[model samples]
Target: MTMADDTDRYGRVSRVLHWGMALLILWQFLSAGAHFLLGDTAVEEFFWATHKPLGLLLFVLIFVRVLWALMNVSRRPQSVNAAAKAGHIALYMLLVIVPGLALLRQYGSGKSFEPFGIPLFSGFEGDETPWMVAPGDLLHSWLGWVLLAIILGHIFMVVWHRRSASQPDVLPRMWR
Candidate 1:
């Protein structure tokens, strides 16, 4: 199968990354939703347990995806318009920013973080850094909700475009 993206459809690598991240993002949202709506319950506990590690995984995957996208930028299917291009750029930004903020707060919390046993951060002594923690505390959850809203809008636009007679049905470009 083709591995590099072209004008017709996403290549094998891109499709795999896209769909795989889609499933992971769906799970991430589920965990977030459970934490927000089912606090102190078994459901929350079950989903929340995977939140941090999965977020780390997503951050890593998005990093790779970004690199791959850049490598194939000249060949990939074009964005339907300026708004679609901006929407995608926004998605990429949020994908990086949201988890990056969490990672910052995690390190600043003076706690060790070894997601998937990678030993990423070692715990530190002393109070957590206010500057590092504050941005996450103030913006992480809020921005997470905002990301979800944009994701929903992204989905809506996909369907809307598919149905509009004048707009291209773009799903197949990414889907297969």
Candidate 2:
């Protein structure tokens, strides 16, 4: 269904990408937590090994999403206010940047860049100095947390807009 916002409800491709990435992100977070709790056992190592591939998948999906968004900018829902616009932009930016940095950190640590079992870069080597790896790791982890915060804020705002404002169907526009 088309939305009153003038955007066609998100097409099948967009919906698939959106929901697929969401699941991947959830898996990543859960896997990370599992690694933390389970330590370096086989299960934890397996989860850690999966992280790079999943992250790469996210990176590619974000790239596709951004390109799709750019091509269909005119069809996106209009923001109800400046705050909404800024928040949306921030979410988009984080989606693009966070995965990118995570991939970079993997590379910087001389690890393989694998996504979904496909090796983007194998036997990759970078500055082995602790300094280089440290900064990359720190930035990657910090940005990830920030991205999570932004996502939560985005959700909260959407819920607020739907419940407190007259627009009870704000989220459906994205589906549209």
TM-score top scorer: 1
Predicted candidate 2, C-alpha RMSD: 3.2
Give the alpha-carbon lDDT of every model: 0.93, 0.71
Q: Which ten residues in a row have the lowest lDDT in candidate 2?
A: 1-10
Q: Write the per-residue lDDT of candidate 2 for residues 1-176, one digit (tens) a residue.
A: 42122463665656777778878988887777777799878888877877867877787788888787676678765677888789878877877777776656666677665566667877555455465466567777677778788878878877887788476556675543
For model 2 the local lDDT of residue 173 reads: 56
Off by over 4 Å in 2: 1-8, 41-43, 124-132
Those runs of model 1 whose alpha carbons end farther than 4 Å from true positions after fitting are none
Tell me the tens digit of each residue's lDDT in model 1 across 116-163. Answer: 788998999999999999999999888888888889999999999999
Worst 10 residues of 1 by lDDT: 167-176
Total clashes in model 2, counting residue pairs 3 or more apart in sequence or in different chains: 6
Clash pairs, candidate 2, are 8-176, 9-176, 10-175, 10-176, 53-114, 53-115
